[model samples]
Target: MAKPQIYDVLHREHEEVSELFHQLEEAKGAEALELFARLKQKLVPHSRAEEAVVYPRLLEESNTADTTREGIEEHKQVDKLLAELDAMTPDNEVWQAKIKVLADMVGHHVDEEEGELFPRAKQVVSDQEAEQLVDEYARERDSFVEDIRLEQRDAAE
Candidate 1:
């Protein structure tokens, strides 16, 4: 099957995350925890894929490099927030507020990626190259997810 464009793939992930955040906000108890876990699973790999597979191309253009650089720093902030979220229980008094902050951070990141970065990236990267990157990013993201699953499985055992 023909892979999607890089923007399409990443944009779809962004949508999923947005939905997850809404669901997370509504949930409580173990359900909230499970939803958060799922969000983390999608998030970490998605960010890593963009960093490894997409950022280099975005960085090639001076116009887009600053935007991409900021996006990378934003990703780091999200990771740090995710780690903090991971360490807290669902019922903790600060938990919901933290989730909101994470969601806001992700929302900002997605807005910039879809609005600013994707347009400039399309100008810099060819349709064929973007198509190729979709596959590479999918592979990279899948590998990261599997590695995380393995680590969790091992920890459980």
Candidate 2:
């Protein structure tokens, strides 16, 4: 079988995140909190790794730079919503509304990324580079997840 490219990895993650958010919508109390935690674990690292490995490459090329910048800004917006959600308990009345907004923002970003940025990236990045990015992004994302796990473990101690 051929190795997966960057988009393939990202697409899988996107689908997972979307599903988590969808599940969260119907969840309550502890279930909602659990879903939110899972979403954060997947999303934060994915964004950071993409910023590290994918966005920088896309930003270098004229065709993709603008779209990449837009994507980064969308990340910032999503992060802000996430932070707000984190501050409040899942039972808070505002939590559902805020999560809906976050989901919409993420959905829009994913649409643009898959529709625009990936196509532009294909135009500029060679197949070899795309494959290399898949590895690099996974490594970076894994490192972030490990750091989070360690931090959580320490906090519990």
Candidate 3:
């Protein structure tokens, strides 16, 4: 069986994050906070894995520097919004606005990746190489999750 494409995994995560964002919109107070937390949990490592492993490989192999560069800029925008969301309470109007902005930014980012980067990447990397990249991404994602958990625990104290 062919290994799953990295784009497939990332695209699925994007959909999951979108779902959590919708859940946040419908929720209030603690429930909204919980949904935001879940969104963070899903996004952080996924971003890290893409930036650390996937983007670099795509940049090198596909020679699509412009696309990768745009992706990095999008990551910065998303991270800034995420940081703002993390710092504010769900009850804050500003936080709500920021979350909406985040959803928009992420939606654009996901479209770019799925529409542009993934197709270009497939043209460059072989199935075996894609599998290897996915494997490396999984390891990095696991480590990222552990780090976030530790940070969350510390923040809870």
The candidate maximizing TM-score is 2
Estimated TM-score per prediction? 0.97, 0.97, 0.94
lDDT of 3 by residue, 1-157 (tens): 6678787788889999999988887788999888988898898899888889988887786456679889999888888888787788888978777877888888888888888888888888887788778789999999999999999899899
**Count of clashes, each model:** 0, 0, 0
lDDT of 2: 0.93
User: What RMSD does model 2 have?
Assistant: 0.8
Give lDDT per model, in order. 0.93, 0.93, 0.85
Residue-wise C-alpha lDDT for candidate 2, range 1-157, written one tens digit per residue:
8888999999999999999989998999999998998899999999999999999989999999999999999999999999899899988989999999999999999999999999989998988888888989999999999987888799889
Better of 1 and 2 by TM-score: 2
Compared with the true structure, what per-residue lDDT tens digits does model 1 show for residues 1-157? Answer: 7658999999899999999999999999999999999998999999998899999888899879999999999999999999998899899999999999999999999999999989988888889999999889999999999988998899899
- Candidate RMSDs in Å, in order, are 1.2, 0.8, 1.3
The runs of at least 3 residues in candidate 2 whose Cα sits more than 4 Å from the true structure, single-residue gaps closed, are none
Worst lDDT run of 10 residues, candidate 1, spans 1-10
Better of 2 and 3 by TM-score: 2
